[model samples]
Target chain A: MLLQQQLDGKITEQKDTGTPLLQVRNLKKYFPITSPFGRLKGHVKAVESVNFDLYEKGTLGLVGESGCGKSTTGRSILRLIEPTEGSVNYRGKDLLQLNQREFKGFRKEMQMVFQDPHSSLNPKKRIGELIEEPMEIHKIGTKADRMERAMDLLKRTGIREDQYFRFPHEFSGGQRQRIGIARALAVDPAIIVLDEPVSALDVSIQSQVLNLLEEIQDEFKLAYLFISHDLSVVRHIADEIGVMYLGHMVEKAPTDDLFANPLHPYTKALLSAIPIPDRKQRRERIIIKGDVPSPIDPPSGCVFHTRCPFAMEQCKSIKPEMLQQSDGHQVACHLYN
Target chain B: MEGYPLLEVKELRTRFSSEKGTITAVDGVTFKVDYGETLGVVGESGCGKSVTAESIMRLLNEKSTRYDGEINFKGVNLLSLPEKKMLDIRGNEISMIFQDAMTSLNPVFTIGDQIAESIIVHQNLGKKEAMEKAVEMLRLTGIPSPEKRVHEYPHEISGGMRQRVMIAMALSCQPSLLIADEPTTALDVTIQAQILEVINDLKEELNMGVIMITHDLGVVAEVCTRVAVMYLGQVIEESDVDALFASPRHPYTRGLLKSIPTITGDRSQKLHTIQGVVPALDNVPKGCRFAPRCPYATDKCMTEFPLLETLENGQKIRCWHHQEIMEREAASDVITAAT
Candidate 1:
């Protein structure tokens, strides 16, 4: 009875309580390509008019293939890179409007865990120092308090407190990811954008980190903008999933719904390609016809039209708008029309 | 000995004499690939899947590595072959495709020239004949407009196309066996399927054996005739594709199978994730390498490593309590669903 009571209390605490944490509207980030003369010649349309609502204490999985601008979208939300266009509202305040001083305070509420731990982490600094530096920069607590917190965070992330003094080289890939997670948690951010956090880790190690993330999210009441290329991992963690293709969210649905009956041809094709482990029940692989179109000079109209199996002539000339085809299910395809 | 395997590795052990110590990447791993069959080697990173493939091709740096095993290719022990003789066997009799096609292919050279080089090196063909053969190989791999694609550099083509080029080059010599190490890891699913289909088609055409080393089980089901599940430098489970998937003997293999999100199953449910992390090479557990993470691990399992035991119908397993574990797992699933 006592254990049941405790579980119920934890479950209620895990429920989202705060207002919508982030609201991105028609966001676009175009990185200018420079010429040999060091002048901005052209732009790479990385994130093109992507819109999504991230509720407080809720995870939103942003999934896409490489060069689909998923990472760019994550970075743009944090203003880690200035958006080329559109508005990002955090806690009802315009994030782009914040100046250097305001942005510093905003940084405390939001943090990012990168894909590659070694590259993101300071090679020279100890793991303890790495975790401490964030707290130090933000001036969260006293020196002794910060050190204690760092040790606790390390333990929370499944890393040994004794290894705090060791450099990044001393740890393995999974341990390094723990250190990365520890550093992200040091800030005590309300939201953490995990960009392919477990992609670099082994499958077994991936489960550990994922389970850790879920446990920590429950304990800390944290929200996540989980971005990854892996659909299976995303299905395990994400409540709501948005499928990105060539800088467009072609489909957005609840994880189960999307997987069960994907409406969009592109989404169906993408799902078909995932190698399920069952040998007896084989799925007819709906191979997308061509590679992802280059973002530099994206095709006019539907970006997925070139590869989509059911692409009509209308799809090639007119861009389809994201529409609510069902309850909480949105798709951007002419087939629905 | 009467029915000879196309390629057989007997007690294969590849060790690297690093400054720290002699680290054995592939230790005492034995397997076989018969003609017109696909052997899927599945394991996580550093589990020596790629290393096993590399050792087969003798691609590992010879200066720092030591090989002790009989790699019998068509009855000849490749480990004892001279460099020149091994070279004759390498591209002529057996070919290998790497993970990254861009890195494997030279950027400056056209696709035709690169593939022609392999044909010229391995076979007694003139430049024109080699170029023509390269086009035929490209066509065989399902590269549309091979004549035009042949003139393009590695950078000019797409990633999938680049992989097709690599396959074309590999099959140009019409090797009896082909080693593909994560050939589609860098490719998208649609492209991966396309490349896989091309390989499958050519295998049937040439009667060539293929060794596909991948972490993805789905790929194995799609192409492989047999599979060997590796864990911590050992083949923990090996069986036919059907039996391996139906009733996986190893806990790790079962965990892997369950962890995968299948479309046919209840997509609403959470993934049956394996509980722990893959231990690092240096910190590999003593008894069963998977015992630490395994749910059904007993004291015997923790203290003694089980040898690969042949089960019903030639299926091999390296687990102490596989039967008991499967029963418990099945019961647990039912109990959980009821609740």
Candidate 2:
């Protein structure tokens, strides 16, 4: 009854759109390096001052190269890895400030779908049991009710009802990912943090999963924090995109706006790097020089200054703040300034 | 060797004997690569694209793996070559760069030592001279300060640099044929572009024939002169790169093209996905291998296997309904244009 009431309240509240479902501000996650004897070495600043808002039923894509801390930012929002600083406001409540007992109540509202379907699901457990495990922990329904709901979720996710008893090992990578999605939906989450969800699957399988995600997002009215390294995949799903580089959000804009008129140099280079399949439409690629630097001791000021083709003297010293270029388009680059 | 192609694979069939049964990984695959040309073999996972490359290089374990058909390199049959003769031709006449550079390189040896080892063995050069050539190869790959980077261990350099070193080592002997199996799959997009550029530059300089085996069509479009689409261990389609992308005759090829969400793709419409997963190697289909997943599969497709027929435009298609599909596509294109 309480869950129904919460759902009803959310439906009414979503219409107003006054505040975001989740508002992240100045989020930072730093991992400390230590010697064998536990002497403090240096901190690997994985995420620094990341900020974004995920409205109800919206999709936010976090994209970057490896070690760009896109995954770190996603984890930090859920407090899966405790954030070193900043606030994660969910419906006006700060998640970072909530204690373990207090946060347990909110955990059901947000769930995560991990990458690598092969390793993520336990080999021994049946697919049905995996979906029901979340509901059983949350104590939402009785045993019979949970089983029915699990079956419904499995059916909705394109899995056969008869195959519910089969183990994860029996399913393909795409099917395993559907099971992962079904399990996430079991808790009835408002926001799902998907980390490189389709990168492991083939292109044909990837499209199926992508389509399934879109369908589920509409049915459940769920928001997504889609974290991936593939720009093309992100472009297809995300409403808004946040481009990160060396633990900082270099640019954030609506998907179409970002791709059409990318303001940041890093964003431009990243956009151009994607090899388009069309033989006729060969793009003028920006081909940025060198690899991403180590995030432990990132370059001063702009982390991307070392790689930025338009890097100026000021870019090496003074950090560029996220300045709004136009409506809903923000970029952190000295060139924009 | 006057009129012979640099590398020509004819009716190649590679099978592996497992505890369950024998599975044909590369079934009757055929293609050719001339000097200064790239032939791209593209397919999804478990489609035997990698197996085809490994078959060409004869890298699979001989105890469990069996090969049939001809792998002719400059008019000489590589499949018939003795093990001792194969060793002489393997790295010296033809080299391969694998997907994972870190795993492919020796962790203990410096990049210089590794590259020099191939040069020393192949060119019969002195250790010092081979090391100098290694640095030159590294420099040719566009790695900055090759002299300093040459001495660094595999772990000491970045992923992009390590890949450059791998390319350096592969090209140190200046092989006429190079087989790159998903060389840039593990790399970041920016780094991938750099590596692809290096490969293209080197290919031109050496006038080498390259066999690029990857699942990514984007890479195929960027580098390949010709492309072969594979499905369930069979080459479904083969054409010039331009013709392949412009008009993919096979249903699997069409499905594969529509499936990928390009950077500039229309976001409003849902992606076209190929129904059903790839069948397991053990459960190989009887008739058309792709008939189970094909949208255009007919009763005839399910009952009889289609031969890989060559079309008038030099395109090969392994589908019974290729003509009908082309006509339907043309009609649809006209409708779209009228709208």
Q: On residues B97-160, what C-alpha lDDT tens digit does candidate 1 reach at each position? A: 9899999999989999999998999888999999999999998888788989889999998999
lDDT of 1 by residue, A1-337 (tens): 8546534543343244456778899999898999999998888999888988877556889988888899999999898999999998988998988897888999978899999977988899999999999999998889999999999999889888899899999888888998999999998998999999988876767767887887788688787999998887788777789999888888998777788889988888878888877787786878776678889889889988888778799999999999998877999999998
Q: DockQ each candidate and list the results.
A: 0.44, 0.59
Backbone clashes in model 1, listed as residue pairs: none
Poorly placed runs, candidate 2 (over 4 Å): A1-17
Q: Rate the local accuracy (lDDT) of all candidates.
A: 0.86, 0.92
TM-score of chain B of each: 0.95, 0.98
DockQ of candidate 2 is 0.59
C-alpha root-mean-square deviation, candidate 1: 2.8
What are the clash counts of all predictions, listed in order? Answer: 0, 0
* Docking level for model 2: medium
Q: Please give, for residues A1-337, the per-residue lDDT of candidate 2 as tens digits.
A: 8545544443443244567999999999999999999999999999999999997767899999999999999999988999999999999999999999999999999999999999989898999999999999899899999999999999999999999899999999999999999999999999999999999999999999999998888789898999999999999988889999999999998888899999999888888888889999987989888778888889998899998888899999999999999978999988888
lDDT of 2 at A107: 97
